[model samples]
Target: MIDGDDVGKRFAVVEHPMQPRALAAPMHRHHREDEYSFVLEGRIGAMLGDTVVIGNPGNLIFKPREQWHTFWNAGDTPARVLEIISPAGFEHYFRELGAELSNGPPDPQRLAALCARYALDMDMSSVPGLIQRFGVRFPGGPSPAPQ
Candidate 1:
């Protein structure tokens, strides 16, 4: 989580690692905040609304609030993405997830509740097809339950 959220501000940045051939997060959308992702390394493939876009290092992409989106690493190497969320606090969701899973395995019920609190709607139905399309692996395991 970024310091901006700690100060109660309008933006927060999170550095997300997109492991080689892995999904970053379930295809989802947030109704409360806009998000921007700046690619730092490797390749990233994203579904923004109805379109699919792939970005290389130094590429930047926007995910407007309330628009359905999802991303994954599409290359043989690992990837890095700097996610900037506007109108902060949502970053806490990511932080808490790390803490939660560290204690044990993932708890979908807890995650769903937390996402509801942050106005995040998740979708995972596209994972299989995407993995086949990109010829990558879904080492992230089971996708999150839909919101």
Candidate 2:
């Protein structure tokens, strides 16, 4: 995905389908960069600390470095978003990790280790509900985090 040192300031545009499953970005907190995202269509629900904020089109969400956050499409339709990152090298992590997971299924143990290395932690209690709602599951284990 991204190399920690090479991330620089840049803008990224993405158009993702609005699927029913509640997608997620593994729990993570950046140590050196800040990120902002603008929704162009539909609504997105973001987790910033213990709060869940619903962001619709024209809404912007910000995550300062070292704050844990995650986001997902919250409505029944697809969404488009513009993601902005300050100090660009972080894209390497996203790209590399994405490529790694793009193949077949993900290895939960490996993913958990990777998340730990990146200061990311995911909660598993909500997982069964997620699967009930989304019909998706990770390949490795029920809870990937180290006990």
Candidate number of the best TM-score: 1
Q: Candidate 1, 81: how far from true, in Å?
A: 0.9
Candidate 1 whole-model C-alpha lDDT, 0 to 1:
0.81
Off by over 4 Å in 1: 6-8, 139-147
All candidates: CA RMSD (Å): 4.5, 6.3
> Mind giving the per-residue lDDT tens digits that candidate 2 earns over 1-147?
233353333533333444433456544577766778788888877778767788889999997887877677776666666666665645555665677788856577876766666554556455554444434333343532221
Off by over 4 Å in 2: 1-18, 108-147
Candidate 2 backbone overlaps, count: 18
Write the residue-wise lDDT of candidate 1 on 8-122 in tens digits. 7779999989777777766789999999999999999888988999999999999999899888887778899999989887888887878877877578899888888989998
Give the lowest summed-lDDT range of ten residues in model 2. Answer: 138-147
lDDT of each: 0.81, 0.61
For residue 25, model 1's alpha carbon misses the true position, in angstroms, by: 1.3
